[model samples]
Target: MNLQRRAVRQNVEKSRFELPVDGEVALADYVLRDGVMLFTHTETPPALQGRGIASALIEGALLSARQQGLKVRASCSFVVDYLARHPEFADLQG
Candidate 1:
């Protein structure tokens, strides 16, 4: 899948980044404080797991954080792992 082309929706009211795929919603939960975005959790429907949905969701969230000029604190293990693999986003880590 072209992760970059995926459309992610940010539900500011819920403090979550959402990616809708095949009728399922993959999401990453976060908390923003002091100009930092702390990713607390991520979930993908059981049927949608292993399809790179979570990765796409995280990438989108990271992109959004960058656009907002916010630093990142990845408390979610998946996000930590993702950041480890993608150094392009390392500069945004706080």
Candidate 2:
């Protein structure tokens, strides 16, 4: 793989993803909106949680938002908290 974070071409190819421990496994997070990326959700493989996989996915999502020039309504609590901790990305969050 070319290590893409914008690979939304397939249902499995995601807008938000994490490749933990240098790509040992991949997990996905997604944002769904009627007309925008209003909420973010994540599913890390059970073994991955203690490894910061969720944070990785959330961070990738925020970076993707900045790259796409999109704003987040932050329906996900994790996203809300992530925004709170990373004020530099606050401009992308609602």
Candidate 3:
């Protein structure tokens, strides 16, 4: 499945990037301040875990931050780990 499509809807009003699963939603939460997007958490429903939903959620959230010209602060351990693994996103780090 195209995770990109799953994460296409970013609900900034809710401060999260969302992916609809089988009637559930996986989300990456964030806080935006001082030109930086602080990724705080990522979550997938128990049934939706292990399906790359969190990865897609975080990817979409980071991409949105990049497009908006915001730096990123990885406050969440998952995000910090993901950033460490994906060096291409290094440019987004604040």
Q: What local distance difference test score does each model get?
A: 0.90, 0.59, 0.83
TM-score of each: 0.94, 0.64, 0.89
Across residues 1-94, which tens digit of lDDT does each residue of candidate 3 receive? 4655544577879987788878898888889899998989888899988877777777777777888999999778989998998898999999
lDDT of each residue in 5-48, candidate 1, tens digit only: 25898999999999988888989999999999999999999988
Top-scoring candidate (lDDT): 1
For every model in order, what is the number of clashing pairs? 0, 0, 0
Taking all chains together, the TM-score of candidate 3 against the true structure is 0.89
* Candidate numbers sorted by lDDT from highest down: 1, 3, 2
Error of 2 at 86 (Å): 0.9
lDDT for 61 in candidate 1 is 89
* Model 3: ten consecutive residues of lowest lDDT: 1-10
Candidate 3: C-alpha lDDT:
0.83
Question: lDDT by residue for model 2 over 1-88, one digit each (tens)?
Answer: 2233343221335655555544455444566555356655656666655766566666666666667677777656776787789888
Record all residue pairs in model 3 with backbone atoms less than 3 Å apart, i.e. clashing. Answer: none
Considering summed lDDT, which 10 consecutive residues are worst modelled in model 2? 1-10
